[model samples]
Target: MIEIMRTMVSYLGSDHKHTALSGGDHLTCEREQGAKRHVQCSNTPGGRIEQLEPCIDGWHCVMNFMILIWQKLHKDSQEDYGTLSSLFARIGCSKAKKPKNDMHTCQAAFLKVFKGHIVTAGCKEFDIEGHKEVNQSLLSSVAQTVVKEFTVIPEALLGESVIDSGDKVHGYARVLCHFASLVLLFVDAWKEGDGERVIRLWKILMLHFHAEKKTKYALEALRLQFQLATLQPYLSHQLTWGRFINTHGGLGRNIPCDLHNEHINKLYKNIISNMGANFTKTASTWAARSVSSLHRISMAFDSPWPLTSRLTSTVKQQLTARGQMRRTSRQL
Candidate 1:
């Protein structure tokens, strides 16, 4: 998802020179340091990167997508860019002088911004009109807020008729909303353990990739399709190792292999940071072991509490409301 999002931003944004396809065959994009890189874009059999790497968290995918959209708008939109900049600022994401060139700044800003959007029991709706408090933590809520806020840019620029506008910026915003909606639906299906629905939505997402193939983003589209093809089997069968736990007591569904690895990496980083940057490797290992033990102990103690149930119910209600809004919007 990160790779796909990065490719999309690079290809779709105003930086055309960086992502030129070579020989109309393979995918080639210039790296940050101006070096040419080639990526296999064919449908032929190859090693899937996800198979070897950790699954990126769904939130990370959405975050990257949101940041990419912001970057795109910063580059392309002139009249309404300030609106987005102000909206981001409301969430503590300060506007950078050069949003397109300073990706690190954009990323850092959104990370802080997302910290407030992390799923929690007291999540609140994001009101664009009043710039209301955004305290939601559910993945769906974040996606919904992203769609609403991003849709504002085009709407502000092209008015209520923005949806009918043939402008490039409008198209990008619409694509962003569509992608976010699909991802939220995918997450809902995955949480519900609905493998069929997951596969269906994934195919729909692949269709978007297919649509991009005829455009300037053809190489990126092809490369994305190739990289994500491996997940089809796992999505279809829902039987891929310990990651796909059938027991409802354990995460309620299959946790992607990457989530676990990423969580551990995050935990390790947090632990190291807390250790004040001068700890020995052995000390860090022991500290990590202790933290793990304490975490298990705390979970065991909290298992009997009703807080978990309440939080779950809250999340469900939020998701249901968001789903209804999506359905209503589609019908209209």
Candidate 2:
């Protein structure tokens, strides 16, 4: 794996082909210092290993590795648990397939890859047919390594003080919600067009996302939500009736406030209700940014803002009218 990663970096690292005319007849090789800096190190299961040994573009390498890992994991999953009750029997629950709490499969895979032991709680003996002992052991070892490298740090969660606990919980809820939204989007994209590759990407992305959330993965989940929103309509339509999306991006006319405005409004309500008076401006701003980004992306797919000024005027007028009605009612 190290050799493979190094070879990839060698091919991607240099800008030797780039040349600039320094004089009338002389062509001097020019290098892109920024690109060189951008890919200085690679993030791997082993952590940041070596920086001087040909800088491995961390983002690119990780992305590529994620693609590879997802492919391998997906293929392994299909082979192991693609059947109906087969998966439930192995993982002990149907919900294990959920991208957020894939503890079962993750545990299994971690064990398989690193520990070399598959711990089965209980299942019909028939379900274990053709299970080679050797393969199971190998997979368990790999799984152990993965679990150690990526599992969340419980200490961090426990360290939050009572006064600021809401922030931590809100952050968690936001991440899970955003993750569900993105997974749904990927599913929707696959349902729409050209989603096979996207679906395959979920495994690695989920792993990395979860790993980051453990200690230092702030806002990655939110950022991913933005990226996914712009790419495909995960939260495009109401997942159910009476659902609404939120207005996102900038305040502009002609942006129909996103088809999913109802959902966003619902989310806002839930967030408010849950957090109550404790909701901070930071949380509000985070939610607002979500709405704004969605609106901006939604608008891009439709008409340019021609009615923004008109809409703003109407909203202000309505609010003013409502205020007057309340004042009159109070006086009465």
Candidate 3:
């Protein structure tokens, strides 16, 4: 998803074309400004602005949601700042500091609070003996973990609607929670390869998304919805062939290509970084080849038969534990 968005951004350059009015002093100023700014403008009866809207991927979708959550929390804090501060303090998020415009801080802070909530609720609801902790290693997908955990947030923690509307009842936080839960349900259906359920959930989610247009993050929400809509056909295609191609005699699950690509990119960058800051392309290529050859030699020496089995078993264990955690979370 990140790769796709980057490609689109590269394709569409920084300055987009726009139309402006003509036959006036404003037209002269517009032309002058266009020439000065190195932007193209045309005279047309009706003005058109070429706006580029990038598709929001899962990572960005969650990040934007976190931003909205943070904004709403702070807005509500104006009424009872101490209450909000204390609530987050319980999760080790001291000092309700305003996050920067980047939204990374917002995501990290909210994720910490959400993870804490999930751990506390899970321990109590599952009646686990001893001091058990959630296996953080199992949560490889931040978006999935966030949406899944959000479904079970205690109602007491979701404060009342700070927006004083005579017609509306539910607050933005509650609505957003429902939306995230719907997304998680949709993902679950997709994982199960239930096409009908996936379609149904998609429709329901679209309806809810349209209803959320009145919220503060309406444009961001719309972008997320558009991204989901655009990916539906691609997701359907994956669902169709995923099981057959990904499994060996119906043994394994389909790995997400986006995550796989991200992992590979990270590995490549790590390798490049290890070779110092100023390595040529040819040198980097040789370095990668050398590493590959060394890995193959090591595998040959260490017996290749156990390697595959070991990886498969490790993956299976992790998947099993993750599934158990999800089931427990749903039950909670």
Candidate 4:
């Protein structure tokens, strides 16, 4: 990345020289100096916004740190519960394949069966398939979609937090969802440069975190709070992170999430899982399918992707028949 930036700035320098010879406007010498400084030691930033953005986003900051907390917490919980439940056992999940008992397969078949996700639990949704590292895009979407949806109160349920703490299933789900929401909000505030808002969210969740003081998550939360408290004085004066950009030159809009180029990752994983060792002619096959999918989306997305679709009529009938068969077998 440093090399790329060096090449880019060098090219920009040559371009600037040409513009100056042609009597065109050019970057000031100070701007050139700042760009060079930005590419230097990323950790010891020159405090310029140009230097700050790449510096902040280049290394793992709040986003990476918080994700590590969530990933470990989520994984540890999953290990105790063991394998994911069968799709047919999950109420609203797709009913397509036989008892292979695979969550990934169920997710894939869901597109065909219901034209949507086969997710039974909203708050528990995670990316990275539990085998890989926590994915940044997954974390991004979870905060926006999953956490947002879970936290928003319905009009009828407004002003009520009636989830029974004693109830095993719903109680646990509620706590997980609420905590996830807190983390995401803190993350969003930091990313958007709302320092006061970040501190406010931390304060709101402070009591709840204290209540769970025995947990590792609470320790992580407190550690984060301490870091934020130290920054409170600076944040009060600085206000938005954009101010840093205006005054300095470092903190830009790039995140070193590292998943920016992984379309082939998905393709290879899918082909290997679905095709196994029989990969002869499979490369061209999936590639053609990929192109065909692109063409369909370009010309006839509405046909392929309806605005609304329910469980297919045939799948519904099959479910009913299977229910009847189970009943008869139980009776016999």
Candidate 5:
């Protein structure tokens, strides 16, 4: 059986030159003399085996071979008749002096070959339309088997298997499906008023992904939580604003300042507000501190200036500190 399967797979895998042997709606028996000559005698005393010529239409032979194999393996019901009938009707003629027309015999021959290959098997006939139903059932069974295999990994991992990059991307898709399912469960819990269960699932999700990827998955998982209203407090706080700022580069600077352009100022104000920061106050404080530090640093650099002399000793020390800060900031 394995050898037969291997041979079939090889044929299916290859598209190279090979003789086509079609027994379409007709089977032909070879004359024993010619058959023996072709099979055994490559070069007789005269030359290559005589009277062995290629078929008139060889593609017919190849199609017949494929259909015949499919029919014998899968076509057993009355339903299959519709599918295989046309092929069955085109059986080849016998390969002999008086070649006989016997398409049914050819179909039977194909079935016999297939049956012999797999096991002691017999065709269990069924109605033609039933073939589609049978096919659907077979597909369903295969799908179930694959899903069952996939479901085992989560259970085996104790619900902690955070899919790493080491896992296949297809497996990552499956993990995504699993996480999505968990999100659904959390949703159900919320719908049922099971607040604890919702929180529990959210925490599990966070912990699993957190431990796995060092918070790489945190934002995405939390985003899922937001939709469910199960995201933990401080998690939103933990949502690093750097992600947004870094995205904008220098424009990502969080410093707030009075802008002459209303559009630009409003845009900055909106962004800071949405990020849960006090835009006006935060910006003013930042700017004020920046100016103060600049003034002090300038005094520290050029001593005994008119404004520098009036500044207090404490202010002078602040200027020295600010000068150091300016130098450090520039280096950065």
Candidate 6:
């Protein structure tokens, strides 16, 4: 999985080409900081890779990379930055200035923060900014805000009257239904996927997403809406999906969850913020911090990405299911 992910990253960055960087008579360390030494980097990709190994290893910056794509496509008339823009808040995809205590916050401003700052620092549209502009401190601030406000309102800006309510509701339902469909697709890829429980969860999400899409809604005719509401735990965690509560429902399958990786990234960024120092000078400190922040377990690098961390919160319902099973057996 990691290798596949790496391949995608390389492809996205156009780093797949292995070209000779430079042939030098000697290698020399330019500066010494603590036990780490900095070497002069040549203009070639190989030279840059060697120079950047300290910052890049063990950490994934795919989201930021995707933002680069989004920014380019957003400005260009040819691409579908429209759909991506719709995924974010205020059409700017930047963080909301106020606390998202209400309905209007989608919290999708992570890329916005960097894009805004980098642009402020002279990164023009479709122009790649220098690595120097990738400010750790700025990123750390934006990371926390994005996590805090990161949201997706499945239903937003629906019609006012009940006559047109179902249109928006059903539309939002379709959006969520499509997501469930994708999950089912990957579940097939994984093989031996537990379809029944997942199907139930999806139906529940679909129903809620539809209902939420309306200015006001009620299910007078449809069957099992009340039951599904009772069974569903999140009750729109996307609206309330802070770093604390977002991972609740996404861990059903045996495979690794995307939210698992995302939260780990958020945690890493939070630690970066709390450290309260520029990592530019102290980037060599990343490895030890990786042991503490990225892994966040005694097993550390031994365990896979999410198998351990997700088990605790995600499987509580399984225990509930088991207890219900025992009670059913006694009743029988």
TM-score of each: 0.38, 0.18, 0.36, 0.28, 0.20, 0.22
Count backbone clashes in candidate 3: 0
lDDT of 1 at 262: 48
Ranking by TM-score: 1, 3, 4, 6, 5, 2
User: What global local distance difference test value does model 4 have?
Assistant: 0.37
What C-alpha lDDT values do all the predictions have?
A: 0.41, 0.33, 0.41, 0.37, 0.34, 0.32
Per-residue CA lDDT of model 5 for 304-330, tens digit only, reads: 655534645453222232333232222
Q: 125-204 in candidate 6: lDDT tens per residue?
A: 22343323556556666543332222122233322322323444233323332333333343442233343443344344
Model 5 Cα displacement at 177 (Å)?
1.4
Candidate with the larger TM-score of 1 and 3: 1
Ranking by lDDT: 1, 3, 4, 5, 2, 6
lDDT of 3 by residue, 145-198 (tens): 443443434445545423333422123333434534554554455345454554
Which ten-residue region of model 4 has the weakest summed lDDT? 18-27
Shift in Å, residue 294, candidate 3: 9.1
lDDT of 2 by residue, 52-138 (tens): 222111122223333333333333243332321233333333333432234334323322221111122111122342333444555
* Residue-level lDDT for 280 in candidate 1: 94
Error of 2 at 274 (Å): 54
For residue 152, give model 5's deviation from the true position in Å: 6.6
Q: What TM value does model 6 have?
A: 0.22
Per-residue lDDT of 291 in model 5: 51
lDDT tens per residue, model 1, 13-74: 54332221111111222231122112234342121211222222222332334444454444
Worst 10 residues of 5 by lDDT: 115-124
